[model samples]
Target chain A: MTKKQIQEKIAFTVLTMTMFMVVIPTLLIIGYIIYKGIGTISWEFITAMPRKGMREGGILPAIVGTIYLVMGTIILALPLGVGSAIYLTEYAKQGKVTRLIRLAIMNLAGVPSVVYGLFGLGLFVYFLNIGTSILAGALTLACLILPVVITASEEALKSVPQSYREASLALGATKLQTIQKVVLPFAMPGILTGAILGIGRAAGETAPILLTVAAFFLPRLPKSIFDQAMALPYHLYIISTQVPNMPQGIQYGTALTLLGLVSIFFMLATVIRIKFKMANRA
Target chain B: MSKISVKDLNLFYGDFQALKNITLNIEEKKVTALIGPSGCGKSTFLRSLNRMNDLIDGVKIKGDLKLEEQDIYQKDVDVVALRRRVGMVFQKPNPFPKSIYENVAYGPRRYGIKTRKQLDEIVEKSLKKAALWEEVKDRLSKSALGLSGGQQQRLCIARALAMEPEVLLMDEPTSALDPIATAKIEELIVELKKEYTIVIVTHSMQQAARISDETAFFLMGEVVEVDTTQKIFTKPRDKRTEDYVTGRFG
Candidate 1:
């Protein structure tokens, strides 16, 4: 009833509310993902190619397509992404161009996935004439992931101590030699981690693929860069929305399969992190 | 007649001059000590010997830095080769996060020294020169980062020595070390001077008085005086040097 007691009560009430507000939503989202996604899990659901409207429909082609996408995307994105990151972090001075490029990448990450999808559809499919295929989807996905790849890679390279560079140079190594010998190895783990995250983002991407590569259905696996492909998310959307005789288990299976794929990518990331930490400790 | 001649040198880190017009002749195969307060540019001047200031983003230099009468900053000079001839040891021990053997091999490897036996010999010689051989000899494959702080710094010194540079620069090499490590490093410095031209910057007046044949005193970027270590410490030519040596002011 006293003022001091009232203040204490209000402080406690706000603290409790704040904690619950953060904790409850995070727990609920994680719980919901597991609850809705844990069922329909099996190797059969993930490794076999999708068969629309069937309980046994597998995401084999979609899985293969995703892997192909990751490969092509990494090959295309890693060089440019890491190279630009190195240039920015190591060589480039903090000037207008560097500042502008950083600001642009930040804005790009913030842009909606649907917006990225439309741009991919326009740039990769329509303009580049790659057509509706794995390559186009990958090119699009690579573009989608480039900003994150560059930012993380730049941070990683920057994380290397200036003393390392100085020590290398003092050893009579040239500037480029110092970076190649000392800076690059130290930053390698960070770049790998960034790459793994980029791959995950690229793999889990559904909206962009829908517009660029997954717009049309292919009963069979894509035969070439010009051929249409099946993606798990698109397959899930199609089976759940378009197919009349689609089995109930197919949607759950596809969702669970997609969840597993993303988790695999994350596990790979964790493994790489451990490798870097161990290397540093050693 | 000395191995290194620095004449009328001034250094500025973007208009804030760090070293005044300073001149000193460093004898070959002899140890020279540069003693000064923090921010007095002893370290800055030491870096100039190897052109290490080029690493600073916007450092400016105006002076004659000559190694045996050859101008160091001339347009024709290769900074890399110059650095190879003049190795530097930093204040804090900074060893590469690599194997003990690889740390020593880094310079020679960069300069195109290949073959396992050759690198092993250099590593062995350099480690022995640095007084680090007995401890690290058996486990050359171990990471340099695993060494204790003092050991790491000595490994860094060994890494620098592996190149077999003509002139060795030590910028407060023992500042980060405890007394035992400092004593070992100081002793090593004195011993190394028998074959190498050594220039060391130290804050400890007693260190300079004990280890150096010749000493230079700096204050606020100016070379206050240059004389024999005994003279600088006991009977300095400049009042400021006398004040600094007597702990009147930094």
Candidate 2:
């Protein structure tokens, strides 16, 4: 073969190798977790409360707490993020103020998740006097994911073809009507994708919950939004690092549970996104 | 009788002048075709008629433009109401990603026609008017995107028709279609003119000659001539119009 053809073949091999590099590591991490933690996953482990400093028994409270936090975050963030995105994409003029707002949102996305935990502790937990509770934790997590949702939702909204908006307007539909009927329907799948990303982040994050609401040893379920609760990430953190001579199996099992919970959320979001996508195409 | 009138109207996009001193009369129940090369503002003029240009940023309009003796550019003209009275079809077929029935029913539904029976009747009537009912009546519930390009364009026309507008603006409505589809749309436009005031922009001079009652030649953001389609196509007026019609230059 000519030198040029040999060079091309070498480039293709290198590129393929790098692509596998990404996939292999991801599979290894998941496979390792499942292998180590699968033995601990049982009916009692999932349904029963932990015993003896979380060294034995199930992580029921952590599981429930993470669910509440995720639901609350979604409730608070989805509408706000989607609304801000709509305003940014459809109504905001290309001006200095709008540009500034956009810049701020981008920067907000880059701010570390720990900063969001601190902000939540300052605003929702202390200043509001709501104390460390599910409300505060959810609010913190929502803030952490707001930038993701807004940016993703804005992209989704913008990806809708401009012709749809023009057609709706020319047919005498008001601006709001056009957005509601034509724009939003087409953008729903994209918006749900953003929500899915936010869910995974919120469920996996320990820092935000650490400052806002995570209880070190809460063994019971939260009675209301005002109650502090144990979450999987924080539970795993404490079990892995804080407890004396913690069982390695329980530590891996907790990590596995968190991973599983986040995966379930991803699956739910994918189902919703597929439904919207089907509706749009049909 | 004039259905819409424009006198010394100018439109600007930021620093660029897109339409300048455009004066013309669109007669009631007649086809008025604006023919010009690309970027000569033929499409801009059509958009200005119904204030669809308002959607663009930094667009400025000056001078008088009216519909049925009412100043459509007045501050309180209610653009939504004006648009309902003057619907539009685009150069490309832009049927919403929805069912054929929903695409036609969308406009009337937005206008507060809520009853299922009422929507069904309007959808059927509009589709029939656009000459798409025979082909698509059985598949009204199917996605509009499933239709051919020609059918999609006709669906857009039906969508506009559902609004029950007195005036219709078509911007090269057949530009994206095959010759057969173009012929179909041309025939529909000719038939539609008997009832509605039709203002169309076309690159095809033959299309203008074939279907237009009044033909206006636009050049460099100005109208070079406006006259009976027969007079403009044959007798000639300005040297520029003659040259353009005779294929000497664009």
- Pairs of colliding residues, candidate 2: none
Give the total clashing residue pairs for model 2.
Answer: 0
Off by over 4 Å in 1: A1-39, A52-56
**By TM-score, who's the top model here?**
2
Instruction: Give lDDT tens digits, candidate 1, residues A198-269.
Output: 888887778988988874455566777666777777777777887787666666666766767777877877
Query: Candidate 1: lDDT of A215?
Result: 42
> For model 1, which pairs clash?
A48-A60
lDDT of 1 by residue, B68-183 (tens): 97999898999999999999999888888888999999999999999999998999999999999999989899999889878988999999999999999999888889999888
For each candidate, report its DockQ versus the true two-chain complex.
0.72, 0.93
lDDT of 2 by residue, A55-116 (tens): 88899999999999999999999999999999999999878988899899999999999999
On a 0 to 100 scale, what is the lDDT of residue B5 in model 1?
91
Looking at candidate 2 chain A, the ten consecutive residues that score lowest on lDDT are: A246-255
lDDT of 2 by residue, B1-250 (tens): 9999999999999999988899999999999999987899999999999899999999999989989989999998999999999999999999999999999999999999999999999999999999999999899999999999999999999999999999999999999999999999999999999889999999999999999999999999999999999999999779999999988888
First chain of candidate 2, TM-score: 0.98
